[model samples]
Target: MTLRNSDFDEIRVWDNENFVHPWEGMEHIGQNERTFTETADGIYVTTEAGKRLIDGPAGMWCVQIGYGNGEIADAMATQARDMAYFSPFNNANSVPARLAHEIAKRTPGDLNHVFFTTGGSTAVDTAIRFVHFRNNILGRPEKKIVISRQKAYHGSTFLAASVSGKERDKGWLDQAQGMSYFLPNVNPYIRPEGMSLQAFLDEKVADLENAILEIGADKVAAFIAEPILASGGVIVPPKGYHKRCLDICRKYDVLYISDEVVTGWGRLGHWFASEDVFDIVPDIITTAKGLTSGYVPMGACIISDALIDSVSGEKSQGATFSNGYTYSGHPVSAIAALKNIEIFEREGILEHVREVSPLFQERLTALGDFPIVGDTRGMGLVGCVECVVDSNSEDSLDLDKTVGARIDHHCQELGLILRPIINMCVFSPPLIINVSQINQMFDIMEKGIKLTTEDLAVKGLWSA
Candidate 1:
């Protein structure tokens, strides 16, 4: 379907004048026009110009069940017409209550209590607040520090952003000072020159322990982390990293909060990666993005029964946990999530991901053969291809050239949209992507990388 030129013009004018995009500079926005996605279906999205492009990042690492799921849309419509807006603050709602029970059944261990939030950021923020509230109830007000790993992307809210260790995201903003601390990221590709993977893992785990010790166990509230650092270039840690981290947190009496905003809901061939993939049950697991498959805005912080029980005692004076959003459990969003989970179970999306992920990883790993490709790392469906000037050297690509962006530009023209982060291009396509679609995506990526390499060579920036 073609939109009229006037329609496109009106949209462009309104967007340029009214829309304030995230993580974008106003100068850049004023200078360049944005590509408006008019429609999406399956694993692809069509732009206003009618160009179809593979959504390589799965719509910001969501959309696990893929796009254009009519069932989900119909569910939302039905719920909206039935009862759209309802307050979940000390009030019972059918859809949220039912969805919470369903979520509890799937989440690992005693993580049976679900606290709904607007999205991942709010979920993360709420989880931290709960930790603080729990500690306060236990008469340990000093235990307010949250230890987060470097390169971890928690969320955009004040507390969540404070917990996030991505320095660039915090440069211009003011974070909640002294509320969170950072540990070095576990990027296997950038581990010490001669250190073995086991040694690197040991050091990382030791760092967590050391940090907890330095902060005083009584002062540390929790440790939050992503199973695989998603937005931070898909940095997959060494084996047994998360399990060891959880052990350290438990030993230190620090609540373990798994930030599975990007890894949850079949992204990693499991409902939740903290237990199914990492073999550890965190005290709190924050999830969003894929919960409703991005059909609607929703997120949830699943709390362990142990934690909830501990904070439910009558020994201390009664205190109310007054933290909640107006739309904490919006009926429409709850119904959307319910339908999303239904699709997952009915279509066996997790099994499909498990079946296809090996091929996806294999295809992504093959890109490492390129001279500019420094590392290929990821698990399940999410992956990243890191580019460097010299594959054998430790030096990174020149920032001015924006090698990843160049590759992404070429890939976009070749029918694929990529998430370019510095020198790395990340891919987390919808779980429903087939082998043929996987091939098509990588083929376009390879061609884009080659074209980028040629452009670099022509500019005297690189050589094979």
Candidate 2:
């Protein structure tokens, strides 16, 4: 489907004039024409210019089942035709009710109650609100501080952004100050020199304890973390880190919120990584993205019965939670999520991810042999390749050169799309990608990195 030059020109002009892209340099982006994605199928996205590139970031770490899934599309259509929108505020809908039941059944521990939202940000925002609400109901209004680790990307909402630790993201943005605390991210690759993995884990846990003590546990509300930090360069913490953190949260009476926005669904070879992969049952689990496979905008904050029980019962006299979204349980989105989960079960996507993840990790780790490759780290199907000017000296990549962006440029030309996060190139392809596809992805990545290294060496920025 080749578009006419006039059609392309009109789209580019309209997009540049009207569309406000997220986390982008608007002026720079407007000056340089945007590459519009016309269509997508399987793992490949066809641009408006008709160039098909493999989607390496899985449509912002969402599209778990891949693209052009007719069944999901049909599900949305059927629901839309039947009943598209309905308020889930006080009123109940069948699809949302059933979907909530299905989600609750799959979630860990007694996280049996589902509160639906528009997307990951709202899901996180809702969870934080619930924490505040719970504490308020329990007469502990001072316990309102939410602790999050540095470099963690929660969401873009006011409360969610406040909890997020990405410094660059919060530059000009105003967050709810004093409402959130920061902890050091558990990046084992950059852990202090000579510290054993166990010691590093202990130090991270101790830092949380110290933060709680310093802030006074009575004033702390909840602690939120990702099982595997996805947007923060795919930083996978040391073994048993989550368990220790959960224990600390429990000891400090802080509600533990597992932000599985990127790690949920089949990304980590499980329905939810908090229990299956990390072995920790958090008080609240916030999920989005793969929940509906990016088919529709949806997210859910699953709360444990224990927390609900604490705030409920005869203690509160006729009190309501008093919060919800208009599209909280939109039938179309609910049906899409339902069919998405059905496809996961019928196709055994989790088993497939587990089967292919080792090879995926191995191929990615092999890129470390490249001269500019500093470190390669990942778990499940999500991974990252960090580039440095000097691996031995640990010198940072030159921002002027934009090493990751250069690699992305090469990769895109070689039939792949890569997410360049500063010096790190992150990969979270669709879970439906097979072994051959994984190899193809890595082959293009290696070529890109090699090309970038050669360019750097020519400019005397690096050496082989």
Candidate 3:
């Protein structure tokens, strides 16, 4: 059936009245404007008016295999038709079982157990809960505090949000107080002005060790970290950071939870970036977004065999973790994940990412030459372009707030969509993006920045 203009208008009205979007503010509740995306395929989404734009953010950094893959769609349909819904709590299913094996074999170390969830938030929530559960099982109920870093984006669930260190997001929302401790920011770009990178690294590592020692390691349950802080403007920590942090965690017997929600499943040229890219096998790795390439909602908390064995087998009789979601290991999502893995292998997408990432990073680094771009950093397919204003002005934060959106607006007009986070424009294009498309994307981004710089100067908000 064809949708008429009136139908679209009615849909928009209904959306305004009924739909409460994620991260919606109170003032923008009923009068918010939004793009009506009509269709999408192959790294491009078509608007309602038939304008096709490159999905620069890759659908919130999830669309690894890109938009509208026939294989994934067929797998979802077949799984739905074969056996869609069943209680995973009391029963086991083949799709999830096979998918679990697929994930287990790819993950580093002995992280062989998989617990599925609906999405990233629930995955992180499950990981945190399990950490607490493990401590409780070991009779150390005081070991309930989680250590995280400033500006890290974990998830939106209660426990996950509690552990997340994005300060601005917590201003109006309530989180589990006193349950999480945050360290300083890890963005190397923000380190002290004359400090050597090695010294900066030492300071960051020292911060973790100090926190563990000061808090008394027995009270700290886990240190949750993103191999690369994705939502915190793609912040890449110093070299050997993860390995050093892992060492500190091991020294203090604190469990390490790697939040690879954005870095996994070929986004970093591997099925998992913990071992391959970051060189540390975490005790628990929470993954989503690219698990099914955002075809269907699914996430996982992959736990190490050692951690699970510590709690099982006669340690305490009749004890249960007793935590799960309704859609844990849903058949459709599991099958989709399996199919995603299959395509990654069959098409050599991981190899492609590794091969083309140099070009991606080169273009991203070149953006730093632009006066408005203060920093550009990334690895694999993910990247960020951060804009800076005159630091001397009191309105610096206010000026920075609109820089990204203004660049995004210009990029949209130029047929590219950006994920603007305050002063940063992040990019995680489809892993299948080619040389031509990469050039096109950065070309448009350059133009967008140019146009935005001109606009900012005209408005007297900033000048570089």
Candidate 4:
């Protein structure tokens, strides 16, 4: 089973020829270059070419407990041996049921009911569908408009993608645009030059309230928000922004859905960040990624008891919710999630995250020392470093696009892998990482940014 360097060459040819990747460009269908990961342990992944790099993005912000956890693998194997497949539609399984109970106890407020999905996209899709179903059952079919914020990333399913407001990701794809309304981007870094922080916060809150008022409260179903917009360069909104938005939603009778795919499972030093970090209990909370710590694929749309209560009972006997995936609540995935939670508790992973996050944030914010670094922001374990070529120049937009990739190239060479989003490089290393590793990661990152800055200056694309 050991793959040699030549084996990877063959694999790369096969990958380029047949395997389509996420966000694949049409021109690069058969010509794409990519790193082939051969194995992983702790916080590092070893490539097929024998390069070991810190998994900076933590396997797309999952892998909370880190790679190669024998415990998790053993749990998965045991679950598969007991029972692997079942129709959750009609039959119920104990694994997912137990996992559901485990999640319900951790989730804030009355979000006590859990519906399983294959991943984050389906989790969000289920949440949206549930909103529609709840509205329909309550005799308010017109209440179907889901409000989302610009730069927010929900997922890739039709319903999820439709509600996601990342402008760059929507250029070539079609989405159910009419089903959603988008609020303005809430990145505090992008606030108007002379505006005070309080003023900006007020304006951001007003955007939501105004959107609900303009759309009419009766038509607005929910306001879905990521506590920290993960994919949007780790944009942290103003303080009290989420709480105020929750109040607005409550005033307008709009449901609040906290999209916690990246924030949940100890990323924010809590099982759920909505109530713990932001002090807002959402009506629905969609989570995945760290749900199984990337050991297996799974996601969940947790429902408030109030919403479930309105639809259940003899009054609505035959009216079914009628939306789910065949692989919903897969036994192996559920067991994996259960084991992931167990590890989180047994190892006090949440406490570890809380202890080390201050250091993580401190080092992350220090990236702003670089001349080309436009902004650096994050909370808990996730962070983003944004680069700018020349904000005032006409060619800045075009030049900026390559900045992240250049930084990533240098970082990978220096034994770090970053998830570059246009001109931004994001970091969400394994929650299991220690302080020394944190220093090492940021040290390499700083060097990478310096190298990239030098490269930009040499090419005459940037000066500063």
Candidate 5:
């Protein structure tokens, strides 16, 4: 095959043995991909194919600050030149230590103790081990099982994948776990015709309480949930729902862990969504993505004073903590993350989100009138426009690419980027996006929806 150097031919996805496309499937390995063709900067990727597409999703919702920030590059450069390689163990890098201190100062609660990792999966893994270890040290070794909501994504680690439901996007991992599952709170707006938000929360919380009584309170270690379901379609929660969830966790004396990997760092109009909107705090906060603004690989597991106190001065809880990554607080990544945090502060990314959030949401909410739009909902930048088998029916559209993929592809053709979140296509553009850009995104996105519906109708996939 005398192959010409086309777009994908130049895609620089460094495929080591461990590389797996995070949210994509194996069957989609090489189909209609703009993998590396989209490269230029500042909002749109000036593709080799000559498309100037607006980055509606902010490169997987991690590029908090806009692209091409020389300040961030310079920060990495300065750190590398000063001290490139050093660990945070014993006597190691001062960069991570300083970064930790700064993060502690910025994070909501006394979530003061920071443990670093290479990415979200590692951050989640660390939280899993830490929860087990903390329980054992606190003399509740029986409390080893974890409780998590359905459709929540923690990470790809063994325990995290196990914590998620049986059927999901990927079918790669087969880890063993004897964990308990609870009925998740259904999104208020998207609830079925007969269902009400209050009723849903009441039933779901009651289920958790009953589950606790059955499993024994002392047997459960922690309750993990993303503040808002990002991957499972940007499902925005109802009012006072999180507070009740928190109250239930406290009632059971179970440690609450917020998986802020998606919602943190201005994604939710605040630094940490746990503190910003919900006014709820958790014992541990697992995070990544925006931490380094996707510049360098980094994640962090932040813990409260109480949990840290439980593990303090206790080798009796099985010698050392028996966890940590080789790249835990890698100097370059730590440097990048540290600089990225500074960028967030210096640029006031959250303020930008606050200023434009109302306008951003108003346009999305207007999409609710669309014939195929089951729901257009979310907080801050993260939002979902669910397509149903019937806009007025309870059944969802075929989870296959039918409607969602058509919309995503249509958006790509219209010079906009989006992801098909289950039956919904999601948009969580960079917090740096202006009001004008927000308007442009929804305008293009609506066009994509119309095109998708028309295409599906031609294929007879349209809901009656």
Candidate 6:
């Protein structure tokens, strides 16, 4: 008879069958028992079966500073040994508080207050709620509609998904977000034949103005956007996009919320993309992922002085304002973030981004001649290759949904771990990567493209 251990006796078979995944991860769940992962190269991931896979997606774009840092680990252990947990209800740890001060010094504009969250999604939820409370405090309770561009991926939470620009994200969502007034984020591919990118952006701003009026400008509380639109196929905004956005937000008294959860850190070849590229001061900025470089989970919603002043004014903000997680401003996470920044500085991560960015563009764009490859675009370490059914028709590939997934699986078989977001195969390697590593990473991807294309052709997917 088999020995029935106490733990095993209570633990029965785990039923994960038929679990509907929130993202595009449902394709993998139906397979045999999941294979565990263990190691990571400078820009790759390894499975439990000893398959060496290039980490093309940078672990969902979080590990911007690469993986396996001894300093980050040490910092976490030291902080844990010193003080593990302290409730921020009244008492709090000095490490996170001081870290908050340091972060404020680094954020754009007069964003003097830093509110911590577990990740980007929660940080987004916090920013929206905070802005709503501020508007209510000012007696402009009617200002409630939060505007986001179409196809934006804010987060997966109920509130976050409600304000998100994606329709699919709202599939399982219930009820409206108590707000609407969404706008376009300037998709150049959709612009008129004669319209320039700048002109198209101008039209978008005009549309925003028109929408604000239609929604009753008083009903619009904030205008939220990503730095360059990370998840929405890495949509790169036209010149003067953020400037005009800031102008419109200021024009209608709508608060500016910049979701830099993917654009922050050295991913954009700068400390903060807002100042580094766009030159706009947002009222709120949400960041995560690279905060600790995936060594641990941590995020921040940096707040401006104007919003803080309104909420903590001569009286309460009227809204109970009782929203936030228990793990907010986690000490261990904060320490890890500090160490990550230190490593970033020591390694000169931003310089590395500046150096290899041009090379990355050259290599990725060279593959544009491939039959299915449509557009290759991105800035700094974050990029994407939008494989379409046919570039001439400009019609997106339906295979990108399934065949492209097979391509990713084929890549995994070749020891390349990459995540496909919507219609593009994204690339966000650790910032510490060298040029040789970048070449090899893309080489593996190019090979996967050829193999996947051949496989698709054999299955009658290719048509003249």
Question: TM-scores of the models, in the given order?
Answer: 0.97, 0.97, 0.98, 0.99, 0.91, 0.91
For residues 33-122, could you state the per-residue lDDT of candidate 1 as single tens digits?
778887999999998888999999988999888889889889899988989898676678889999999999999999999999999999
lDDT tens digits by residue: candidate 5, 80-119:
8887777556557778888889889878878999999888
Tens digit of per-residue lDDT, candidate 2, span 1-464: 57775798878877877787898784587665767787999989998777999999999999999999999999899888888888776577899999999999899899999999999999999999999998888899899999999989999999999999988788888999899999987899888789999999999999899999999999999999999888888999999999999999989899999999999998999999999999999999999999999989999999999999988879665578887888898889999999999999999999999999999999988999986788999999999998877544435535423798899999999999989998899989999999999999999999998898888878887766
| CA RMSD of all predictions | 1.9, 1.8, 1.0, 1.0, 3.4, 4.1
Q: Give, for candidate 4, the lowest lDDT window spanning 10 residues.
A: 309-318
* Candidate order, lDDT descending: 4, 3, 2, 1, 6, 5
* Root mean square deviation (Cα) for candidate 5: 3.4
lDDT per residue, candidate 3, 218-315, as tens digits? 89999999999999889999989999999999999999999999999999899889999989989999999999999999999999999999899987
Error of 2 at 209 (Å): 0.6
lDDT of predicted model 6: 0.78
Estimate, for each residue in 55-119, the C-alpha lDDT of model 4 and write its tens digit: 99999899999999999999899989989999998899999999999999999989999999999
What is the TM-score (0 to 1) of candidate 4?
Answer: 0.99
Instruction: Give me the runs in candidate 3 sitting further than 4 Å from their true place.
Output: none
Whichever of 2 and 3 has more lDDT, that candidate is 3
Q: CA lDDT, every prediction? A: 0.90, 0.91, 0.93, 0.93, 0.77, 0.78
